[model samples]
Target chain A: MAVAIAEARIGKWGERYYSGRVLQLLERGLIAFRSSTWMIVFSGFFEPVLYLLSFGYGIGKLLPTIDVGGETVKYAVFIAPALLATSAMNGAIYDSTMNVFFKLNHDRIYHGMLATSMGPLDVALGEISWALIRGLSYACAFMAVVAPLGLIPSMWGYLAIPAAVLIAFGFASIGMALTSYMKSFQQLEIINMFLLPMFLFSGSFYPLSVFPEWLQFTVNLFPLTHAINLVRGLCLGHINVALAGHAMYFVIMIICGLFFTTRRLNALFMK
Target chain B: MPESLIHARGLTKKFGDFVAVNGIDFDVHKGESFGLLGPNGAGKSTAMRMIGATSSRDAGVLTILGKDPDKHGPQIRAHLGVVPQQDNLDMQLSVSENLYIYGRYFGLPRAFVKGKIEELLTFAQLEEKRDAKVEALSGGMKRRLTIARALVSEPEILMLDEPTTGLDPQARHILWDRLFRLKEQGVTLLITTHFMDEAEQLCDRLIVMDKGSIMAEGSPASLIKDYSSKEVLEVRFGSDRNQELAEKLRTLCERIEELPDRILMYTEDGEALLGQIYASGMHPKTSLVRRSSLEDVFLRLTGRTLIE
Candidate 1:
């Protein structure tokens, strides 16, 4: 009955591509999540925590403090927010890319959903929203670990959770969009190839100034660079107009990713 | 006459340069069981997809429940329950959850879907397997669960593509009985099948399709009557001699088909034809007499067997 009302409301436009039942897909994902192996889900949450313990704390003893935007901070504090951003990206990308690829190619889940009144846009939105849940939970989990350790020094650090979500939203959107075009499991390896270098060189560990000017410019183009910068600024209380610019990059990514994901899904299943 | 639940005129689809459905026309009325009977790659599944509102027609007119599919795909799809050729049940979910999620996909209320799940489980005869994962079920059970999932929306039209294609004989009979129950309940059924026996058992009306075009359209009995004799006489002297006897056998019946393994003599009376063949001093290794069927109709129309 709710569907009928929603359909009547949006009946004029986008009815061919959307049915306003995206939450139903979320419901399905949640149910499936209950039965799925919890080890993999926990592995995504634990990945950054391990990185923090090893790199942030272990390496922090050797190099005590770093200067960011003229504000001096411990090395552990500087990298904690970046780890949070990385955790969010990893969680969202894993769910959106690998899990979604399996469902799309092997399980044929979207074929079943689209055969109903639900459309391609509903699937794209529903799936991306589910991935965001994983991203959000990981952000919260990372914050829970770092907050007690004095890694977040500023009251403004609370905003990092939302920032992590935004970062997750960007990666999840683009991940699904890219995964839609993948035809085989081997092609999915290309994602990890790009992600590894982005994680290492996106100024997550050290300052981007350490690289050559051309290399720094290339690193800045990575979405992770903006994500790390945005979250780090909030954690260190380095408030500036530049923060909104980073957020806007993700907003544009969200829009473009959604547009292409919906189009690709429609072409693949509804053609 | 009842209004058509589905209408198609010159309906066509193309994948690259290959035409899948080419300028076919048909109408399915409310509460009728309509079949698209054809061999593989005969365009039956393509036409089914267009009417189900999942695939767009490249050039033609298609309307389901009085709305254009290209413009109102979701609205039209809301009235349809589609069972695809493959069993696409979510392996992560159990049987009941599969049905419940499908209902939710149609935007049905949660409480309503929960209630509907029990009824559908009972309808599909999977009540004992409700909590079992889809992967654990047998092929027939999986197919039944898929059908149950399709009915979760209580759709006016149920579109099944090759519903019993891979099932054993007993499983096919069970599926046929379930479909018959749906027909009795007045649900409009649209089925696509390469199995002539399945079409004969289920469809009230059907279109014979071949090479992306409709060869003929009618009820099973009418098609057999129009295109075949009343009965068929099957006689096999041996593989080597079957072809040799084609010319002599051709003179004994209204029509004859010389298959590699056997000779088919079409006549109004198979028993009388056999006696005549025997009187002509022709002794066959084996002989059988049977009533004409959709197989004979298909052979007569296309010069090929339905199963190929």
Candidate 2:
């Protein structure tokens, strides 16, 4: 009886573009992970931790404290949220772009999946959700480490976990959309080139005020800047209207990313 | 006539200016093994893709199981088992895991798929390699596993595109035997193959295609009878002499084809034609009389070999 109702619902909603079996892809990813190199999966979680230790502690010793918004906090506290946001972005980007590129071009995994009852939307949502899991885990791991160090000063700081997922979602959706247009591995290198500069200059390590107005405007255009600001605002208890803007930025990114990823997958495999 | 499972009329697909599948029409009936026989770039794979619901047609009407594929692609694909020309198995997963995940993609219950796995493994003869990674398997094993994976959904129509293109003769026979069993079990098969022997061994009915158009359509035997003679005499007077000897050989038989290396004489009695050639004082280096095949039919229809 339950199966009948579910089928009826799926029949009505699918419209030949989705089958509501996105989670099955997650199941496949998890099963595949059992035999995959565990070190690579674990490595994303450590990137932020290493950055915190080397930059937060090493630089924190020299600076002692920094003024964020109106509150004066230890140098480690200010940069911790930025690293959290960066890690979420990094994990999501790596999973969605490089890993997805390999699967799309080399493994032809999506081709096999689309041949089943599953549609392009199912594949897009499933893969993006998997990348989000990696992003969410990195955020949670980063929070667990920093919360013990007293880097998180407010109760609202825990919201950064979901916020980190949003950040991951934004980067993942856009990353996948862009990766779909990539014909060669060298084209993928262009993404990395843009990502490195965005990471280094998106006020991840210092204040955006240090850059010229034109430069700051250019940096603000980078999605990482909004991610860092949003995560930093939550961790530092500097909640304001601007944070909503940052969150809205990701909401828009997610929509655009999903739209294009589905269309591209359909065009590439189903056309 | 017996419940058409697939129907197409004037179906066409174009890539820019190149017409991959021109306006062509055919029907596949229930419990029949249908084939699209053509060489590479003959649009057989393109037509299969349209039937598989993975590609949308540029023009004309196409319906699978009485539903328009363009409007019901996912629903149509749910009933299809497509073995693509290339093996797209998940390299990251073990053999069984590839089967497991594929069933799950169709929303099959875990228990049902788990049960189906053993039956398919036995059928594909891959029970011993259940835990083996796809990359670790040999070519034949990989092909069998791909076919097994396609069956995980218990699909209504099994579509194989060049199912045995790259396997050795032994492996090809084994694969053909498995496909033959599926036919015996009443699975509707849609296959595309360039090898004449494979087509003759597997297809119940077929359409010969060249340059995106159907050149001929019939059962293997009927096509051979309609377009070719009962027997063929292959006489090779050396490569240099083959063209010169073809003029004389033509008058001795109903039809003669001058290939680069040999001259083929088509007749009702190949032995009689060879005797006549010998009586005419034409000494050939070697002569053989054999039954005509789909290869000869293709040659007659398009003036070209099927493999070329």
Candidate 3:
């Protein structure tokens, strides 16, 4: 009976979800990343860091050290955490959306992956994990650069790394879910149109309160708004109970996004 | 043959309004090579997909490995391996990595897959190409690698869709040899193909299908025997005047068919028919007598050529 249970546990369909296959996909993803390591390493780490050097030192020198929510904070202090949020969102959304779509359509990688015991759920989860790993890496590097520059106001900023991962995961899951429905390259332009504007206007560069009341309400609906605010709150060492609401928003988004993405992937590939 | 390993009744698959597989029922016994043979759009691949538990059946009593595919797809699929018509290998990975990752999908430990990878590569004759990327391999090598990858889980049944289509004659023969070895090891094979030669070479029992339904079912030899006469006489006349000669040659054969390219006479002995044609003073450009084959069976059932 024990032998039979062991066999059943290690059986075929059960096998696809095993840590071994997940590890293999993770290893393959990391290996593939190595092939283009320079692109990810430079783009993920340097882009946010470059923005810090350029704007924090170059632009912030001209802007007065402003009072944010009653505390006198440097202009760089206010913007660095927002950069962290945007970088995390960028890392997650880009990898999960465009890269996943290319592998699904042109490379036929998902087709090959599905031919194994790995179901659509496994692929969705695996890709999202990679996105979070990438997002966390970028968040850490950006934090390191900003820390030496005295941009981090308190130790609560360390919590921003995991927060960035959650933020990125929510976007990555939703991005992959949306990518599953897209058919043509021309249609992907719509995603760029949506993503770029959200990055520009959704409080990544400025406070949401700077916008008109109506515009603030509109941008509030965007996932990145909550993510940026959460990181910003943490970075400035302002621990507010309202931060729980932001955390809940990302948690809910991750759940729904993962659920929807898995469903969409299965519907598309398991036919 | 013991109880049927695969049993289906009223199995159907409809894509929107167009019915792809319309209510087919069949069972596969253990350790048998069963085939679904048909032309280009015959739902053979769809049927194979349903049996492989990768596609859903709209309505049916379907059981694979004693489980309902609708509720137990992964369970059913775990015991089965499928090679789709196209070679969907991971172009980024080395040939061995393809097999290794596939084995990992079945949740095999790395050490187990490491040993199996070498054995599988040797079996596929890809030992030298193990480290080469999939994009660098030849077409036949890719197909062999696909088959090897499917075998990584050591499945009980293997499903191949058009396993040898588009392959050169030598490659096709080599694939057939490998498949025959698998059969000798008592692994059941369910194959779908439009190629008559492939069906005849690999299938033990086959169902000829057309337009999403089975037209006939029997052993390859029995199918040829039941649907076709012993021999066929091919006659090509000098010109359009061939029609006039065809009119005169009706009395010399059992059944006469006038095709755009040539005339076919289905008879017991083509030599006697050719002699009668010669003695009757009807001259033709060329004539030949050949034994009827699965090609004849296809032509007789579909009223068209097989390769088309």
**Alpha-carbon RMSD, each predicted model:** 1.5, 1.6, 2.9
Q: Write the per-residue lDDT of candidate 1 for residues B249-281, one digit (tens) a residue.
A: 888876899888898988898899999999998
lDDT of 1 at B176: 92
Expressed as tens digits, the lDDT of each residue in A88-176 for candidate 3 is: 98888888888888888887887777765556777888888888889988888887778987889889999999999989988898888
Give the per-residue Cα lDDT of candidate 2 at B156.
80
Superposition error at B278 for model 3 (Å): 2.7
Candidate 1 wrongly placed segments (more than 4 Å):
A1-7, A10-13
iRMS for all predictions?
Answer: 2.0, 3.3, 4.8
Using Cα atoms, each model's DockQ against the true complex is 0.67, 0.60, 0.38
What lDDT score goes with residue B14 in model 2? 98
- Report the TM-score of chain B alone for all candidates: 0.99, 0.99, 0.95
lDDT of 3 by residue, B201-278 (tens): 899999888878777889999998999999999999965877877778888876777787789889889998899898
- Highest DockQ among the candidates is held by which one? 1
- Please list the C-alpha lDDT of all candidates, in the order they appear: 0.90, 0.90, 0.81
lDDT agreement of model 3 with the native: 0.81
For candidate 1, the iRMS in Å is 2.0
